[model samples]
Target: MSVPVNGGDLVVSRLSSAAPSAPTAIALHGITGNGWAWLPVAAGLFGRMSLWAPDLRGRAASRLVGPPYGLGTHADDVIALMDHLELERAVLIGHSMGAWVGSLVAARHPDRVSSLVLVDGGLGTAMPSWVDPDLFMYAVLGPAIQRLGMTFPSPADYLAYWAFHPGLGPTLAGPTGHLVRHYLTRDLVQERGGWRSSCVLDAVRADGSALLDDEEVLTSPQASIGHGIPVSLLWAPRGALNQPMGLYGGAWPPWRPLPEGITAERVPDANHYTVIFDPPAVRQVVSRLLAAAAR
Candidate 1:
């Protein structure tokens, strides 16, 4: 289900087994991901909290929504979703780009965010100004950027493309196969001759540009924490390709560390994408939210 937002309906997946007043958690997915990406976390927390995962504008079901897309717009959209739900305050859980969005929300709408859980994202290191944004994105995101421009004859073709995806495909062979397939295909829209990914390239570019220089949102939380809002970060040990090293390397331009007062933890044996679905990773996320709710 989805609710009306600034530009269009934000598709939301609701998972609830508790009372309506149970501590509510609003989830935000990574840059290329949609609401359904948080299904595992919601499932893990079933019967405990009412979860709402929304597809931010220009991704998945919200692809048609026009731009003005960036971290600020995304933060506003999240607040709008909270308004639609009539929620005064809720825990905000974000993964990757979603984590960045969560930080902005916590900074701008502190009253509406009770706590923050950032999974492998909110603190993505910024690139130097001399580095070309497109080139940097290409180097970091690699084929993920290229796939957004390609087209496929059918959902099967798209699935085939991902058949060898280093982190996602091999993991799809188990009980979670069906769920994985749904996650991959959910954002696809059939076009005139074929199907293309629902993620908007222009929006993605705009977001990447914003992320390159947006330090305030990621760091401002240190000040915001003084207001009694708690923030936690759970990062994977590897990159998107499941590399041994994490995204932020120890190079000259090292990834900026989490600001003071923000708790941080690492998910061992997990990469950028796999962390959300990893069993231990999911447990950590579930435990954090439940503990926050208990307080």
Candidate 2:
């Protein structure tokens, strides 16, 4: 179910087992993603624990708000939702940009976090100087436009458009494609004889600026391991960003080296986007996180 929080909306979905005593886990998706992104992992952990996944502000079902869309603001939204639910602590699982927001929350409000699992993100790396902000905006916003492209004459037309995205895992081409089609058809609204994406494009543009501003958030010292938070970083071995680390001599954003107490694991044969979608690898990372939190 979805819940409203301060400043914007928070899309919350829960999965729990027959037993009521299970621990609770909260999953946060990357940019341009929604709660459904964690559905596969949540399914695997079903009955083992109760899972809550939220589409961060401006993405998916979450409400879009004003700009200066920094990590701190997103972190604040998560905190407010947790407070509303009366959850004192949760094992925070975040992917891509979500991982960075999760880190900020853990740092600023350590009391609210029981543990943290950063999925293929939060490693320190510098922003690419060459990519112009406008160009970056187009590339990042492309997926959303494609998804909400048009009020198709029919739903099949919409489904066909979604099939072309490379980010959806290879295995998802079959069943998941149908699932996405259903979501779009149901979520979109017909206006002026064409379907408009539920999301506000202007909000996306503002949020995009914050996300691509790697220098501000990525270079911040607060994101460093020195904050003394219990953290685990699951990195994708084949990630595009990871490849550059080897070539660039490890100079990256979040500009701090791995902390002494953190556990950093490498997921083999996975890239930035695939690490979250691949079942086996995701399960392994989640299981390891559960084990670590138990300690």
Candidate 3:
């Protein structure tokens, strides 16, 4: 369903079991990902929680969403979506960029977000002040951001690209291949006589810049997050592209002066991409959602 927000309509996918009383949760995807990225999470939470996954602002079906694009606007969009659904409050399950967005919502509009589950993201990386925004995005996102500008000849070619991705390869070749393919196909668009990623670079730049420059995004979750809200940080040891060190390396709290009132855990063997799709990792996420709901 599409609900018009500030700039354009947000396309949200509602997935649930037959039970109408199931707890509801919002699943937020990564920087260039679409709502389908949460399909695996929905499956894992099939009978327990209903999921509302939106093709956040400027990607996939919602790519036409115009300016006022940044994590702050994305937070507003999340609230708008909650209002559109007539939901008073919902748990937020976010990955990568989505995690950061969820953090903002939980901090700024705490009454609207009951709990926050951040997967491999949301925690701001302490980059040097002098580092350029463009370079920071490239350096931080690494191989995952390279496909935004490249054109693909066909859907099969795009599948091939994902098939070889170090972090995503096992996911595409594993039991969740169909779901993975569906998610990837939704991110493709035909234009300029060839197919390319639907993620907008301008939106990416704005969001990335905010991660570095904006105080709202730069603040830790413990600073402004509402009291009694459960914040869970699930980190993958490997990087997004399956590198040895991930965003937080192999440690859960990889920095000094740890934030209080948050639960942190590591999903072993899953990289950033696989953390949502892999069975073990999905179980980890599901368990957290269930815990949040029971709170």
Q: Measured by TM-score, how close is model 2 to the native structure?
A: 0.77
Cα deviation of 57 in candidate 2 (Å)?
1.9
Best by TM-score: 3
Q: Of 2 and 3, which scores higher on lDDT? A: 3
Model 1 lDDT per residue over 130-236, tens place: 87777877777666777898999999989888777776666567555666677789879888999988998878877778778778764646646766788887777
Which candidate gets the maximum lDDT versus the true structure?
3
Report the C-alpha lDDT of model 3 over 119-191, residue by residue, as the tens digit.
9888874567797887777776665588887899998998898888888987887888899899999999998
Error of 1 at 224 (Å): 3.2
RMSD of each: 2.5, 4.5, 1.6
Measured against the true structure, the TM-scores of the candidates, in listed sequence, are 0.92, 0.77, 0.95
| Each candidate structure's count of clashing pairs | 0, 8, 0
Alpha-carbon lDDT, every model: 0.78, 0.61, 0.84
Least well predicted 10-residue stretch by lDDT in candidate 2 = 246-255
